[model samples]
Each structure stands twice: as C-alpha cells, then as structure tokens.
Target: MTSQVEKRLAGLGLELPPDWTPRGQFLPFRKDGVLVYLSGQICEWAGEVTHTGPVADTPEGIAAAKEAAKICALNLIYRLREACEGDLDRVDVILRLGGFVNCHSGFPSSPAVINGATEVFIALFGDDGWHARTAVGVSGLPGNASVEVDAIVRLKD
Candidate 1:
C-alpha cells in the first residue's frame, strides 16, 4: 500500500533514491525511543557529488548553493524513510535540522542556502515539517560539498 507520505512525494514529483550506504564509518541514522537522528547528508546522488567546492558569496553562488542544499534534503529524506522502516507516515514531526554550508569566511547567507532544505520539508509535511534549525557557514565540509544537512525527527508511537 502506498503510504500518505509516498503519495505526497509523488504529488511533488519527487522520488526517493535506492537505499544508500554510508561511504564512511558512520551510521546513517540512529533511533532512540520515538526519535530518529539522521547524520549529515551532502549533495551527492548515485555516488557522485552534485556540487563541489565552497559556496561562493555572490547572488549566483547562493542560488547554486541553495540547489545543492535541496539535493542534501532529498538525501536526508531517503534516510528518513529508511529510519521509518520505509513508511514516512510514521514521522510525527521534524524536530530539528542542522545545516552547514562550506563557504569563504564571513559569508552571511548560510541561512538562505539552508532554506532550500527547509522548504522541501514544509512542502512534504505541511505544519509538521516546521522545524528548529541552525544554519551556519563552515570553512569546509566532507567532499567540499556546498551544503550538508542533518535532521532529528520524532515518530508516532
């Protein structure tokens, strides 16, 4: 049976990718009671980095970084589904998101870039998707990804 979340994803023309294995030694997600914590996800798909290098601090750079953030969101959604046993409807709420953007010093648009991920969750889950978030500029990230996002989710019992 198609879950409500799956239906919503279809409505948005979004498809989750196949199961992903962490390239590093870290776990993708960890569950404690009803909460699931997702590790940081970058803008990579099918084993290729969609966007590489530190984000530029120009308008065009922010736009590109936003797109990269969206990719990271998609990857996070994929992991969330896995954490939910393939049923996203089990997600009660998105508790928080931590966004990191690799950029030059003093870049002030990290929040704008991370909004790409936040918007995706809101589109998917409506009010339930609204989450506490921390968006910060970083000197570098793994693979030099433009953006990386980690999430904490609460699940329905």
Candidate 2:
C-alpha cells in the first residue's frame, strides 16, 4: 500500500532517488531506539553529483546551491524511507537537520542556501517537518558538493 508520505511526495511531483548507497564508508542511517540518524547526503541524482563548487551570493551561485540543497533533501528523504522500512508514515517527527555549504571564505548566506533542503521537508511533512537546524559554511565538502545535508528523525516507538 502506498504510504501517506509517498502520497505527499507524489503530490509534490517528487520521487525518491533510485539509488541510496552511501557516498563513503558509512551506513546511510543508524537507528537507536526510536531515533534514526541520517548521514550527510550530498547533492546527487541518479548516481551522479549534481552540483559542485563554492557557493557565492551571485544569482547563479544561489540558484545552484538551492538546487543542490533540494537534491540532498531528496536523497535524505529516501534514507528516511529506508529507515522506516519503506513506510514513511512511520516517521513520528523530524528532529533536526544539519546543512553544510561549500562556499567562498566568509560567505554569509549558508542558511538561505540550506533552506532549499529545509523547505522540502516542510512541504512534505508540514508541521511535523519543522525541526531545529544548523547551517554552516565550509571551505569544502566531500565530493566538493555545493550543499550537504544530514537529518535526525524520529519513528513511532
């Protein structure tokens, strides 16, 4: 049966990425009791990195970062689904998210760039998606991705 979360994703014209492999030597998510911790997900689509390079305030850079953030969110959602055993309705709460943006030294718009991923969760889960978040600017990220996102999620006990 299609889960409510799946329905919501469909409603948003979003689909889970086909591949959920970890980008490096780590599990995609680790579950402890009811809490599931997701590893950082870079902006990738169909097994290819979608965006790379430093984020700047320029219109093009911002647009690219936003797109990258969205892709990371999509990847994170897929991990969330996996954590729930393929049933997104099992998600009880979205606890937190940490976003990292590769940018020029001292860039101040990391939060806005990470919002691309933040907005996706809010759109998918509504109030339940609201969570504490941290957005940091970094000189580089694994794969040199423009944005990387990690999430903390809760599942029904």
Candidate 3:
C-alpha cells in the first residue's frame, strides 16, 4: 500500500530526517499495545533549529515558528508511519498533542500558534484529526528554539 505520509511529504517538498536521539538518556517514543507516545519534537531540521527567541521579542520569528510547528508535526507523522511499516492509516486516533512556545511571559496567540499542528492534522486525517491539545508558554525550550510539539496516537486494529 502507498504511504500517505510519503506522498504528502513529496507534495509538500519535505523529507523526514532520521530519528533523533533524546537528550539526557530519554527515549523519543514509547509504545504500549496500540498507542505510541512521541516525545516532544523541536522545529529543528538536521540538527539546526530554524528559529529562537521569545515571540514578544521576535514577531516575524514567531510567525515563522508557527509554520515550523506544522512542519514538525508532519515530520512526526513520517516517523510514526515509518515505525508502523508505512501505514499512516493504521493510525486510528491522533488523540492528543502538546505544543510548546518558547516565549516570554507577555506573548499570546498560543491557540492560533498551535493551530499550525491542528490545521495540518485535520488536513491529513480528516475527522480523525480532532485531538486534545495543550499550548503552553515556557521560559525556554531545549534547544532555545521557538516551538516544539509532541503527540500520542492510537494505532488501528
């Protein structure tokens, strides 16, 4: 069967980089029966973080960070599909998402910010895309990047 993850990536002109090892002895993903918990993924590509600094400090950068979050979600999908032997449809429920905005205390727009992933997930998975999500502002992100996101997806029967 054709992988929508692969085809969508091609349509979007992107390719998932290899799995990234977690910092401090942490693992990136853990599966229990039918659900997979993916550790938070930063908006970095090839070890290079696309942007940094708080949204209040960097407006244009914040806009870019929103776009980057969506891309990060796509990358997550690719990794999940690869792990499941190339069947994205086997992903029955993309149950939850947690997004981080590496921003200062005054920064706002978190819901719209996380909409980056929300929008993409819907486009990709249709009604199955609905998910519980958290959009949080933090003092800083692991790599000082402006955004990061993680997910929990329930595998199909």
lDDT of 3: 0.76
Q: Which pairs of residues clash in candidate 3, taking residues 3 or more apart in a chain or in different chains?
A: none
List, residue by residue over 42-151, the lDDT tens digit for candidate 3.
77777777767465545566577788788678667756776576788788878999998888786777766778877778777778889999998888887787788899
lDDT by residue for model 1 over 41-121, one digit each (tens)? 998888777887688888999999998888898899999888998889999999999999998888999999999999989
As for candidate 2, its clashing pairs are none
Instruction: Mark the regions of model 1 whose C-alpha exceeds 4 Å error after superposition.
Output: none
lDDT of each: 0.90, 0.90, 0.76
Model 3 ranges off by over 4 Å: 57-59
Per-candidate TM vs. native? 0.96, 0.96, 0.87
Candidates in descending TM-score order: 2, 1, 3
Error of 2 at 58 (Å): 1.1
The pairs that clash in candidate 1 are none
lDDT of 2 by residue, 1-157 (tens): 9998889889989888888456689899999999999999999888788899788788789888998999999999998888899899998889999999999888988998989999999988889999999999998998888999999999998
